[model samples]
Target: EAGVVQSPRYKIIEKKQPVAFWCNPISGHNTLYWYLQNLGQGPELLIRYENEEAVDDSQLPKDRFSAERLKGVDSTLKIQPAELGDSAVYLCASSLGAGGETQYFGPGTRLLVL
Candidate 1:
Protein backbone atom coordinates (compact mmCIF):
# COMPACT_ATOMS: atom_id res chain seq x y z
CA GLU A 1 0.00 0.00 0.00
CA ALA A 2 2.98 2.23 -0.13
CA GLY A 3 3.26 4.90 -2.79
CA VAL A 4 6.07 5.24 -5.29
CA VAL A 5 9.47 6.19 -3.89
CA GLN A 6 12.27 8.21 -5.52
CA SER A 7 15.72 9.03 -4.26
CA PRO A 8 17.95 12.07 -4.21
CA ARG A 9 15.07 14.49 -4.64
CA TYR A 10 17.50 17.07 -5.91
CA LYS A 11 20.72 16.83 -7.87
CA ILE A 12 23.14 19.38 -9.21
CA ILE A 13 26.03 18.78 -11.53
CA GLU A 14 28.14 20.51 -14.11
CA LYS A 15 27.60 19.93 -17.79
CA LYS A 16 29.19 16.74 -19.11
CA GLN A 17 28.74 14.94 -15.77
CA PRO A 18 26.69 11.84 -15.32
CA VAL A 19 23.57 11.77 -13.15
CA ALA A 20 21.26 8.98 -12.22
CA PHE A 21 17.75 8.78 -10.80
CA TRP A 22 15.99 5.93 -9.09
CA CYS A 23 12.35 5.00 -8.66
CA ASN A 24 10.40 2.29 -6.90
CA PRO A 25 6.83 1.98 -8.03
CA ILE A 26 3.82 1.12 -5.91
CA SER A 27 3.34 -2.50 -5.04
CA GLY A 28 1.47 -4.68 -7.52
CA HIS A 29 1.57 -2.04 -10.18
CA ASN A 30 2.42 -3.56 -13.51
CA THR A 31 3.02 -0.44 -15.54
CA LEU A 32 5.77 2.07 -14.84
CA TYR A 33 6.78 5.20 -16.68
CA TRP A 34 9.50 7.83 -16.76
CA TYR A 35 8.78 11.41 -17.77
CA LEU A 36 10.62 14.63 -18.20
CA GLN A 37 9.28 18.14 -17.58
CA ASN A 38 10.91 21.35 -18.54
CA LEU A 39 10.30 24.71 -16.89
CA GLY A 40 6.88 25.37 -18.37
CA GLN A 41 6.07 22.24 -20.30
CA GLY A 42 3.90 19.36 -19.32
CA PRO A 43 5.59 16.08 -18.52
CA GLU A 44 6.68 14.17 -21.62
CA LEU A 45 6.90 10.45 -21.54
CA LEU A 46 10.46 9.28 -21.91
CA ILE A 47 9.86 5.60 -21.44
CA ARG A 48 7.16 3.19 -20.33
CA TYR A 49 7.49 -0.30 -18.97
CA GLU A 50 4.90 -2.97 -18.60
CA ASN A 51 6.52 -5.11 -16.00
CA GLU A 52 10.05 -5.74 -17.26
CA GLU A 53 9.37 -4.94 -20.88
CA ALA A 54 9.77 -1.48 -22.26
CA VAL A 55 6.59 -0.83 -24.20
CA ASP A 56 7.45 2.64 -25.33
CA ASP A 57 10.70 4.53 -25.47
CA SER A 58 10.66 6.53 -28.64
CA GLN A 59 11.14 9.79 -26.85
CA LEU A 60 14.09 8.67 -24.82
CA PRO A 61 17.41 10.13 -25.91
CA LYS A 62 19.50 7.07 -26.54
CA ASP A 63 22.65 9.08 -26.93
CA ARG A 64 22.94 10.05 -23.31
CA PHE A 65 19.91 8.69 -21.50
CA SER A 66 19.10 5.16 -20.57
CA ALA A 67 16.58 3.37 -18.35
CA GLU A 68 15.72 -0.02 -17.00
CA ARG A 69 13.09 -1.72 -14.90
CA LEU A 70 14.38 -4.50 -12.70
CA LYS A 71 12.23 -7.56 -12.16
CA GLY A 72 9.23 -5.43 -13.10
CA VAL A 73 9.44 -3.56 -9.81
CA ASP A 74 12.08 -0.87 -9.47
CA SER A 75 13.56 1.30 -12.19
CA THR A 76 16.50 3.58 -12.76
CA LEU A 77 17.12 6.40 -15.24
CA LYS A 78 20.53 7.68 -16.15
CA ILE A 79 21.96 10.55 -18.09
CA GLN A 80 25.65 10.55 -18.90
CA PRO A 81 27.45 13.67 -19.92
CA ALA A 82 24.30 15.55 -19.12
CA GLU A 83 23.85 18.75 -20.96
CA LEU A 84 22.90 22.10 -19.45
CA GLY A 85 19.68 21.89 -21.40
CA ASP A 86 18.85 18.72 -19.52
CA SER A 87 17.99 20.56 -16.34
CA ALA A 88 14.44 19.58 -15.51
CA VAL A 89 12.20 17.49 -13.31
CA TYR A 90 12.15 13.76 -13.82
CA LEU A 91 8.91 12.07 -12.79
CA CYS A 92 8.11 8.44 -12.16
CA ALA A 93 4.58 7.08 -12.39
CA SER A 94 2.88 3.74 -12.16
CA SER A 95 -0.49 2.08 -12.52
CA LEU A 96 -2.14 -1.28 -12.16
CA GLY A 97 -2.33 -1.67 -15.89
CA ALA A 98 -2.16 0.23 -19.14
CA GLY A 99 -5.89 0.73 -19.52
CA GLY A 100 -8.37 2.83 -17.56
CA GLU A 101 -6.33 2.71 -14.36
CA THR A 102 -5.34 5.87 -12.57
CA GLN A 103 -1.60 6.39 -12.56
CA TYR A 104 0.23 7.55 -9.47
CA PHE A 105 3.23 9.82 -9.60
CA GLY A 106 6.24 10.19 -7.36
CA PRO A 107 7.58 13.45 -5.96
CA GLY A 108 10.11 13.54 -8.78
CA THR A 109 13.83 14.28 -8.96
CA ARG A 110 14.95 17.75 -9.88
CA LEU A 111 18.17 17.83 -11.85
CA LEU A 112 20.19 20.93 -12.46
CA VAL A 113 23.01 20.96 -14.93
CA LEU A 114 25.28 23.94 -14.72
Candidate 2:
Protein backbone atom coordinates (compact mmCIF):
# COMPACT_ATOMS: atom_id res chain seq x y z
CA GLU A 1 0.00 0.00 0.00
CA ALA A 2 1.07 3.57 -0.58
CA GLY A 3 2.33 5.37 2.44
CA VAL A 4 0.14 8.38 1.84
CA VAL A 5 -2.90 9.55 -0.04
CA GLN A 6 -4.00 13.02 -1.13
CA SER A 7 -7.12 14.78 0.05
CA PRO A 8 -8.55 18.25 0.57
CA ARG A 9 -9.32 17.75 4.26
CA TYR A 10 -5.79 18.06 5.45
CA LYS A 11 -3.30 19.39 7.93
CA ILE A 12 -0.64 20.83 5.63
CA ILE A 13 2.98 20.77 6.66
CA GLU A 14 6.44 20.68 5.22
CA LYS A 15 8.21 17.38 4.93
CA LYS A 16 10.56 16.27 7.71
CA GLN A 17 8.54 18.12 10.33
CA PRO A 18 6.77 16.67 13.31
CA VAL A 19 3.03 16.22 13.60
CA ALA A 20 0.66 14.89 16.20
CA PHE A 21 -2.97 13.82 16.30
CA TRP A 22 -5.20 13.30 19.29
CA CYS A 23 -8.36 11.37 20.04
CA ASN A 24 -10.73 11.21 22.97
CA PRO A 25 -12.87 8.15 23.06
CA ILE A 26 -16.27 7.73 24.58
CA SER A 27 -16.62 7.06 28.24
CA GLY A 28 -16.23 3.41 29.33
CA HIS A 29 -14.36 2.42 26.21
CA ASN A 30 -11.22 0.52 27.00
CA THR A 31 -9.87 -0.47 23.59
CA LEU A 32 -8.29 2.18 21.39
CA TYR A 33 -6.97 1.83 17.88
CA TRP A 34 -5.13 3.90 15.34
CA TYR A 35 -5.55 3.37 11.63
CA LEU A 36 -4.40 4.79 8.32
CA GLN A 37 -6.57 5.19 5.29
CA ASN A 38 -5.54 6.06 1.81
CA LEU A 39 -7.81 7.28 -0.94
CA GLY A 40 -10.34 4.73 -2.10
CA GLN A 41 -9.18 2.22 0.46
CA GLY A 42 -10.36 0.87 3.76
CA PRO A 43 -8.64 1.93 6.95
CA GLU A 44 -5.65 -0.18 7.88
CA LEU A 45 -4.95 -0.92 11.48
CA LEU A 46 -1.73 0.54 12.78
CA ILE A 47 -1.89 -0.03 16.48
CA ARG A 48 -4.25 -1.05 19.27
CA TYR A 49 -4.01 -0.65 22.99
CA GLU A 50 -6.14 -1.66 25.91
CA ASN A 51 -5.99 0.40 29.06
CA GLU A 52 -2.62 1.88 28.12
CA GLU A 53 -1.03 -1.41 27.18
CA ALA A 54 -0.35 -1.86 23.52
CA VAL A 55 -1.82 -5.18 22.43
CA ASP A 56 -1.32 -4.89 18.71
CA ASP A 57 1.27 -2.80 16.94
CA SER A 58 2.75 -5.10 14.36
CA GLN A 59 1.81 -2.76 11.54
CA LEU A 60 2.99 0.46 13.14
CA PRO A 61 6.07 2.15 11.76
CA LYS A 62 8.01 2.52 14.94
CA ASP A 63 10.90 4.49 13.49
CA ARG A 64 8.74 7.49 12.59
CA PHE A 65 5.40 7.06 14.32
CA SER A 66 4.46 6.49 17.92
CA ALA A 67 1.18 6.20 19.83
CA GLU A 68 0.08 6.21 23.42
CA ARG A 69 -3.12 5.93 25.39
CA LEU A 70 -2.93 7.95 28.57
CA LYS A 71 -5.19 6.69 31.35
CA GLY A 72 -7.01 4.70 28.69
CA VAL A 73 -9.22 7.68 28.00
CA ASP A 74 -7.31 9.78 25.50
CA SER A 75 -4.88 8.74 22.83
CA THR A 76 -2.21 10.47 20.83
CA LEU A 77 -0.32 9.60 17.70
CA LYS A 78 2.91 11.40 16.88
CA ILE A 79 5.14 11.40 13.86
CA GLN A 80 8.69 12.71 14.13
CA PRO A 81 10.39 14.02 11.01
CA ALA A 82 7.34 13.13 9.02
CA GLU A 83 8.09 12.41 5.40
CA LEU A 84 6.15 13.14 2.25
CA GLY A 85 5.01 9.57 2.17
CA ASP A 86 3.43 9.97 5.58
CA SER A 87 0.52 12.03 4.33
CA ALA A 88 -2.83 10.31 4.76
CA VAL A 89 -5.93 10.16 6.89
CA TYR A 90 -5.30 8.97 10.40
CA LEU A 91 -8.29 7.32 12.05
CA CYS A 92 -8.95 6.78 15.73
CA ALA A 93 -11.48 4.35 17.05
CA SER A 94 -12.49 2.92 20.36
CA SER A 95 -14.60 0.09 21.66
CA LEU A 96 -15.74 -1.24 24.97
CA GLY A 97 -13.32 -4.07 24.57
CA ALA A 98 -11.13 -5.77 21.98
CA GLY A 99 -13.61 -8.18 20.48
CA GLY A 100 -16.54 -7.77 18.13
CA GLU A 101 -17.99 -4.71 19.80
CA THR A 102 -18.92 -1.69 17.74
CA GLN A 103 -16.07 0.75 17.41
CA TYR A 104 -16.61 4.47 17.50
CA PHE A 105 -14.43 6.41 15.13
CA GLY A 106 -13.45 10.01 15.31
CA PRO A 107 -13.31 12.35 12.38
CA GLY A 108 -10.00 11.41 10.96
CA THR A 109 -6.99 13.69 10.95
CA ARG A 110 -5.99 14.29 7.37
CA LEU A 111 -2.31 14.99 6.81
CA LEU A 112 -0.63 16.47 3.77
CA VAL A 113 3.12 16.67 3.81
CA LEU A 114 4.56 19.02 1.29
Task: Point to the candidate with the largest lDDT.
Answer: 1
- Give the 10-residue window scoring lowest on summed lDDT in candidate 1: 1-10
TM-score of 2: 0.89
Tell me, what's the RMSD of every candidate? 0.7, 6.3
**Model 1 CA deviation exceeding 4 Å by range:** none
Given candidate 2, what's the lDDT at residue 91?
A: 89
Candidate 1 residue-wise lDDT, 1-114, digit = tens: 789999889999999999999999999999999999999899999999999999999999999999999799999999998999999999999999998999899999999999
Rate residue 105 of model 1 by lDDT.
97
lDDT of 2 by residue, 1-114 (tens): 111211223588999899888887777778888899987899999999898999999999999999888787788888998999888899888888976798877778899999
Q: Candidate 2: where are CA atoms >4 Å away? A: 1-9
The local distance difference test score of model 1 is 0.96
Give RMSD (Å) of candidate 2 vs. truth: 6.3
Best by TM-score: 1
Instruction: Give the TM-score of each candidate.
Output: 0.97, 0.89
Judge candidate 1 at residue 39 and give its lDDT.
92
Q: After TM-score superposition, what is the CA distance of residue 94 in candidate 1 from its true location, in Å?
A: 0.3
